[model samples]
Target: MTTIELDTTKLRADRLFQRKRLVGFAIPAVILAYLTYIFFAFDLPGLAGRANMDNAVTLVSDSWSHKVHVTRDNRSGEISYAVEGERKGRYPEGARPAWVTGDEVITIDLGGDHIVRYLPENRTEIEIPNFPLIEVRAEGRSLVTNLPDDLPGWISASNRRIGITTPEGRITLTGARTEVFNYFPGWELFWFTLDSPYHGQSLSKILFGERVDPARPNISGAMSDWWNNAMWRHKDVAWAIGETILMAFLGTMGAAIIALPLGFLAAKRFSPIMLLRAATRRLFDFVRGVDALIWTVVLARAFGPGPLTGALAILITDTGTFGKIFSEALENVDQKQIEGVSSTGAKPLQRYRFGVIPQLVPVLLAQILYFLESNTRSATIIGAITGGGIGLMLTQAIQTQKDWEEVAYYIVLIIAMVMFMDWLSGWLRGKLIGRKD
Candidate 1:
């Protein structure tokens, strides 16, 4: 009875809640419809295939033991087998072996093909080639070269001759009428073809392709060695990185000197002259407005490319930034201290030197440390444009494409350098402005 009728307001609120629930239900349906449309709306096979191919390249399959099983549900008249190994494998069939067993390990002929219809179970297969044995004929010489030999060598006897060595391990050559050979090393084949007048590819252009002709010299080994060679091992890259750091350090120091006077001139309290303060502030703004990279391009063109150009650009950019920041710090200085110094009949310069400078020291030092860290990155960027730093080598490595590992190496070096700079900045800040915690 005290409750009387249901409150109309409570009923209204319940209706709003129901409306919200209905709207929420529609959101999932809309999202589902959109996803369905996107999945079906375009040809995505190429994109999907590319992603899968990338996975395939980096994938490492579990090592398969040499023991392989070949069974005949019922032997008709023929048999076949495949030989797979560390470097290469092949399937030889039709011209079947007299017999086969799962426990046996053997080598097959390179590029030999045979058909297998020997099993009623519909098993069709052939023996793989001997591990790393490639049937190679160089010029007029016919030989089965052991891949792991210090230099490739052919079997003294028949193509079925036994024994081969490679970097991986030793393998016995097996197979009747099957020849084993390692063609000239891959790099030799490449250099051979390249040196040939008949070869159309230039050394630089071929480098771009990273293709080593099979007929050339030890191309693969040479390429592998080259890619793995450390660019930083060279004195030039070390010199470049050193110059970049020097540019940032000296540039920051020079800008600090330039900014101190300009900053005081820009501060109304410090200058006590409105016109001089306004003019200095406007000049600071004008300089800092342009990006550091733009400055690099201008100076590189104007002064020519070198470390000097890089340092100059940093100096110009930081001067403006430091000027503005220092001016603000000066404006925030406590007036009471200035008055206390003035009451002692100190001159204006003396008053500022004794009163305002002490408070401004921590803020200025903090800003300088931060700017130094920032300029380190800027120096690398400037080096890139001016063709003089580790960045130049990085760009070259990328352009060559075959030097991807070198690219990886340089990237790690740059990241390490940045981490070092960050540590230095933190230490300096703690020393100059005491740790907050």
Candidate 2:
């Protein structure tokens, strides 16, 4: 009998080993099959072939650098110098950059021996260190260039336009205008635009030296100029950030308020009715399963794009989430505590207020505070769709394509805002629920 029992145990162990081996091999085989399907489905190789590395490099460079545009109208022969080609950043009348010389024939000295000369009567000349001199003349509605038939990759010339790209700068000649872009490090006019009195003054001089603006005090005038800067729009950014925070706060708190009662209705222990519990659970699933982005789009159409719409979207989505979580917490409550309250002849509402709430407070507050922090980031994305908050400014900056520095600034502010929310949530959590360790 002992021999038979041992033989039976050995047979079972061998079968179990075979089953485990089959599972291990099958899991990897399934994963490999899925990955193979995805590789062909995504067309990754075709995407790689179509990507432009030069444009990617230029976009990355533009994020950290600024460009000065020197444009001369071919028809009127009028020259203009501007930062990033914006009207607000245009140089004051009759004022040109130090690198440019000659009034009649404007000479733009791009560093590293690259020079561009804008002569009278729609004539232009570009000289690079190792390359031959390029001369282009714009007449009527066409561009005349001394470019070879077999030109290099950097130069693209046609009857209507001539484009030259170099390491130091880029020069483009067209029938309507001749433009030269000189690259420089850092964001130009970030602190103050050309119109501001404090444009060129050093920080130390502005703080301690004589008044720069004759009409107002040094510090106040400087502060006002920086705060209301037209180019950077500091005031607008601050207001947008405030709106984002307000959206997140309203959405998270409002969801918590609405979810608490719904949570009780969903909890099987609190609501004995099977139909009611199932309906509440289904409602929670429907709201949350749709996703916040979908809610944002749907609500935006109903209410129009605004912070309030984003707030309502967040509130609706989070209400479902909070209801589910709170219901689970309610279901796990100590039955002994509820029974003790009932023995004291306490009413149903009072029993819940005293017995159930104390137990669920920590879990509810923890979830709410955690969601508040997470929702802050969610609100930024929601605001972008709803056309409000810092996300709108970020989207606008990205759409411009030339305002990458502004994009970088907005990204920094968004990160700082998230960090601040994280810290605030942690503090609130600690205050409400005593720290664990």
Q: Best candidate, TM-score-wise? A: 2
Best by lDDT: 2
Runs in model 2 lying further than 4 Å from the true structure = 1-11, 341-345
Give the lDDT of residue 227 in candidate 1: 34
Tell me the whole-model lDDT of each prediction, alpha carbons only: 0.60, 0.92
Instruction: For model 2, state the Cα shift of residue 178 in Å.
Output: 0.5
Q: Which residue pairs show collisions in model 2? A: none
Tell me the tens digit of each residue's lDDT in model 2 across 380-437: 9998888999999999888877788889889999999999999999999898899742
Candidate 1, lDDT over the whole model: 0.60
| Candidate 1: worst-modelled 10 consecutive residues by lDDT | 60-69
Q: Write the residue-wise lDDT of candidate 1 on 274-351 in tens digits.
A: 998999888888778886788888988889987888888889889999999999999999999999999999998898
Q: For each candidate, what TM-score against the reference?
A: 0.53, 0.93
